[model samples]
Target: MAGQIPIIPFGPHATCTLELCPIEYSIFRYRPSLAANITFVVLNVIFALTHLVLGLRLKNWWFSGAMVAGCVSNIIGYAARVFLWQNPFSFIGFLLQIIFVGSAPVYYTAAIYVTMTRTVENLDVSLSRIKPKLYYVIFIVCDTGALVLQAIGGAVSTVSSGANAAGVNLALSGLIFQVATMLAFVGLLIDYLIRYFRDRPVASVATRLKLFLASLSLAILLILARCAYRVAELSEGYNGVLFHDELLFIGLEGVLIALAVVALGIGHPGLVFKDGQANLTKAYSPVSVPGGAESGVELVGK
Candidate 1:
């Protein structure tokens, strides 16, 4: 059995002399953390349910759908961890967690990008360097690209028995791309906020708008931190020392994402937009006139 190559369905009797599967050998070497996995599963379930209820009540279909997708991925990812806890050799479980959890945040960030567009529309679109629609177009497209790279890389790694160096590189590239997109978004967000406040008196800004901006900013920061940590983790190959640090994974990946989801709930778009209440027809209007007529042009030059 010592000389035989390790094969799937690994067990005590298998001829595969390999000490552990590369997918999550660090986790398998020691029993997977049951408590940590279960906690994440529960947290994701709550986040999913809350978002669904709020989304339906507020009629925010797009936001709700993205959050639901992320939650489902989290559920599957942690459930995979639970399976690994039972049997570290479960290849299917390892693949499930790796792909789903790794890409789940992409959906969340996309939702956030959409919200940014809405924010710009709601608050002085003239203040932003980029138009509201372009924010959605640019960031969502970038998010899609990141999601594809990650999904492809994860699939390739799974097919290669989790030993492919190319797969890791592809995934790392996706993470790095995501980080760059987020940084650019932050720059735009800061610029818009600064210009809006400087041009318009602070007293004109609504308290609710302030809250929404604060909440969105917090979520973005949390996500950026999580993605940065992931980039570092993957920088080291699968066998890198980072894999052995369960606490780091739990804190950076699990806890940070969980907080971001919850922050979104607190700062939900529904709170500000008020379900068909905002006059989107006047979103880019320069001024309001009698009979609810808006100035036809956005003459305020950027």
Candidate 2:
């Protein structure tokens, strides 16, 4: 009995522990790095608190709420990873990480979509090919679908103990769908920017506006990259080489998403848009020009 492999339950609710099973029985094939997962947990907590404070101070409810939710999901997911570090064969921990971490970015993308709508309206609604509100409706709907798919897939995979190919395929499809949606959103954003710049060229762009746009763009690109990596990792299923590579997972999943979260904070729309909204109100007031015409609202550059 000393050399015999222990037979243990293998579903999401498995009762197996390291004492009963060999490390090879774990899906990860190695213990999760406690230091790395703990770092991620701490980072997510800091970002969540920061967003909560900023949201309350600025009354930016929607953006702040979405960011806080995403960060909380990351915290839970990484905490699950920490659980795995302690007990490498924990199926529940694996389930929690896969479901929460995989779906967390959907909230971030929703936040970005709403911001884009506001950005288009604040800058030049007429320049956008579609109505500004459509951006919110379209992207958010797609993001929600991706989140649902991922959650369901994770559940299915856990119940099957990674044996059901359909579950892995479902998760992969969700990630791929998310990547496609982001690409489309980025395409539309670029188109709108080109049209706006061509129609209304400014002599000097405001530093605040530049920083906001740059940070937002950086976050978008990073999230897109992370999603793409997830798609690749899931394509090979749980037993694949890429699935077992912790270094790649840490870099692409943990580090990239953390940077994206920081970018979102840097580009907090409340800071940039608050003044612009006030200026917009004043511009739209029934003020008269010297030429006996109504004053037109110009885009806020500062």
Candidate 3:
């Protein structure tokens, strides 16, 4: 293994003596471009900081925590890529990107699950096909399963000497499961939307609800695209063409997730449910009576 690929620096490299180190290799061969990696790291850090400030300001404990976790995971994953740029054969760096970046989106998905439950509760849970509580219960549980599979797969592959079919399959199964969950969740969301609109006119809907739903939808699409790309990449094993294509990785995984994070921030539930208005289970609002007299109704009351 030590003599497999020539060691770097064109000399007796100190770090390449381990079982995982290549005899000779360039970081470029593994990581490709360094510029994009650095950009993602910086962007993630900025996004994390922004989420922290907003989360604190709005006191959205759950949403803020989930977003911050996802952002930090992105930052750490890209930082690992930076280390890989320095030493492409670094097993630790590879592991970091695989587990952190691969599993980070699960946190964001959890946040979305929570937000959907809250949305249904706020708008009209009776209008939804599934119960509001079931939203988080089902999706979060599925997300946890996906996260565990990916993490275990990363660990197994890290320890496995060469291309491990079992490890790759585990990781692929996790990605596939994630995509399936996303599809199901989206179907439910669309169903709820259809039911809600069918019962109530779009004009009667609150503007805040519209913005929040749109943002959540955008994030869902971005994450789905990123996860699908990962599934395809991992299905081919480590040495596959998609695995080596840095641009595709940056565009599909990094760029898509970055946009999703930003979209969530814009559609942060705090924007709508603020000042202890987070739980709208029985929220109500003022409505007009038959005699043009204003009356209070349970329609998103503040």
TM-score of every prediction relative to native: 0.83, 0.88, 0.84
Question: Over the stretch 36-88, how does candidate 3's per-residue lDDT look in tens digits?
Answer: 88999899989989989988887888988999999899889988888877766
lDDT of 2 by residue, 1-302 (tens): 89865476467556667787777788888889999999999999999999999898777789999999999999999999999988887878888988788878888988999999888887668788899889989999998888888888878887887789888888778888889999999999889877755533343344566577789889999999999999889889988899899999999999999999999999998776663243343223233434666434433233
Candidate 3 TM-score, C-alpha based:
0.84
Identify the superior model by TM-score, candidate 1 or candidate 2. Answer: 2
Best by TM-score: 2
Native-vs-model 2 lDDT?
A: 0.82
The TM-score of candidate 1 is 0.83
lDDT of 1 by residue, 168-236 (tens): 889888889999999999899888878766644555445555677888989989999999998898888
True-vs-predicted CA distance for residue 225, candidate 3, Å: 1.0
Q: What Cα-based lDDT does every candidate model obtain?
A: 0.77, 0.82, 0.77
